[model samples]
Target: MAEIQPVIEVCDLCKTYYMAGGLSQSVLKHISFTIYPGEFVAIMGHSGSGKSTLMNILGCLDRPTSGTYQLSGENVSDKDDEALAIVRGQKIGFVFQNFNLLMKRTIADNVSLPLIYQGVGDEERRQRAVEMLKKVGLEGYEDRLPSQISGGMQQRVAIARALINNPSIIFADEPTGNLDSKTSDEIMELFAKLNEHGITIVLVTHEDDVADYAKRMIKIMDGEKAYDGLRADYKENQGA
Candidate 1:
């Protein structure tokens, strides 16, 4: 028997942005980590800690300036934009702070957007979208538009949209940032349930309460990983 490789493998990853004249800004310093299947990992950092930058790279929305990134064993560092888009749609799901849904579109229509890009037939697309909605506890809300639902329900619809393609990893960037504490707990519980069902989750949040829900906690400081490990004993080593 062989051990399974990580769902995401990032090594010596660095990113630098060049200003208009000549100076450059470094967003990610030689960061490295491996995210395995069925793991729920939370990255905690204050603003300007590069959490969003890391999320963009991890979600295939941006390429790194240097170093390696492998997704399911395939080197994605050099993939062209089109290839990256394909990988994003096929392997990664994204949930953001703002529920990025079309205001006028029905929940089913929004969830079906990904399948539409995959060129799935109309009937198949609707069926798959409905199935994903059911998984996210949004069955009856399929006919409602984004504005018709509560913030939490809209977020659930966003989650369903993210899961429509059955992605191996879900990248959630402050997913519950806009919700009330109660709604936030509901969403976090939903994420835990999803993780139990075997979907890898990588979350970015600055809230300690939100990070506690994850099995592993990764702390970032100034674009570098300050700590990464199990959350059980994270507090024990606070001063160590």
Candidate 2:
């Protein structure tokens, strides 16, 4: 059988910031990894560990100091802002620690926001948004505002919005950071269900409980790749 190409590839990636007075700091150092289709990967790191920076770079929100990032076979490392935005809109979905929904908009409207950029007409956008909401078990809550829902439900809305675009990969940063343990577990299970349907998931979190949900775990320490392997192996190593 032919080996399928990776949906995401990072090679010798590095990110550095130049400061005032000629000072400089590097956040990510020579990080390299590949995420194949249908993979559920968690990147675990502590504060100042550089996981968020890596997520931003992989999601095309930022560029690295030096290295290559290929998404679905396209080298996106040097793409201009406009080009990057186009790729991000077409190929990537983002879920953040805080459910970044507009409080004034209805749940359905928030989910439909991405479709507007794709030139999807209002009617079709409504259709797709509701369909996605249904998939996330929020079918009847479409008319509610973000402020009206619980934190978990708001996160569900975020997930529904992320899926409405049907992107190849979902990048979630601290997706359950604000939720309670039970709620966090529920949200992770939702992510697992999405992964089961073949969407590639790469999430960043500091909690081992959250990391355990992914099939593979990548540990980053001080801006470098520390460990990359199956979640079971990572757990065994964690135990040793």
Candidate 3:
């Protein structure tokens, strides 16, 4: 009988960076949107389009200069770094284009790093890492070093690492930027499976093929929301 809550809500959000000459450049201009639970959304934009800045704010890695950002009902726009870090660790998972794995650590160790920061004990962390890796189809690759794996498998490890925290949302920024098309499709399929399990996913990508995997697409142009609609609507509206 009760209305479900939004996983993320952004209201009139704006971010500006001060320059060397007393100048300021805005990255997000009055951005407003809402993402509900179980949604697979893609934030699409080219370089300098402010999509990266928006991702930083959404993932609690940075704060907005104006307006409000509510993540799971908590106002995060003004949270200090420590507070934001806690929020991010507890509620969000991040996957970067570079895979961001430690080359020297085993895949299992890399996946366990977040739980370590969360104060999880060694045995539990290892167990959870194995579980997550299995989820990402890397069952036997746990003991392998990142350098020993193919680029695609390394990315799978990153995705597994992202899931080990059991976050409410996963924010993947250009997750397939380094992969070949065949491997990129595999990764996107993996993301789709995760989304089906009710974990909210919002990835940033400039490629149409990548964005098409998401149900919803929000196009950012010049630091503003150019379109927010279903992927088909976006395609039709954009004349794709």
Q: What's the CA RMSD for each of the models?
A: 1.1, 0.8, 1.0
What TM-score does structure 1 among the candidates reach? 0.97
Q: Write the per-residue lDDT of candidate 2 for residues 67-97, one digit (tens) a residue.
A: 9999999999999999999898889999999
How do all the candidates rank in terms of TM-score, highest first?
2, 3, 1
The regions of model 3 sitting more than 4 angstroms off are: none
Q: Distance (Å) between predicted and true CA of 206, model 1?
A: 0.4
For residue 67, model 1's alpha carbon misses the true position, in angstroms, by 0.4
Question: Please, what are the lDDT tens digits per residue for candidate 1 over residues 161-203?
Answer: 8898989899999999999999999999999999999999999
lDDT score at residue 159, model 1, on the 0-100 scale: 91
Report the C-alpha displacement of residue 80, candidate 2, in angstroms.
1.1
Residue pairs in collision within model 3:
none
| Candidate 2 overall lDDT versus native | 0.94
Q: Write down the lDDT that model 1 would get.
A: 0.91
Per-candidate TM equals: 0.97, 0.98, 0.98
Model 3 lDDT per residue over 113-168, tens place: 98887899999999999999999999988898999999999999999988888898
C-alpha RMSD (angstroms) for model 1: 1.1
Give the runs in model 1 whose Cα sits over 4 Å from its true position. none
On the 0 to 100 scale, the lDDT of residue 152 in model 2 is 98
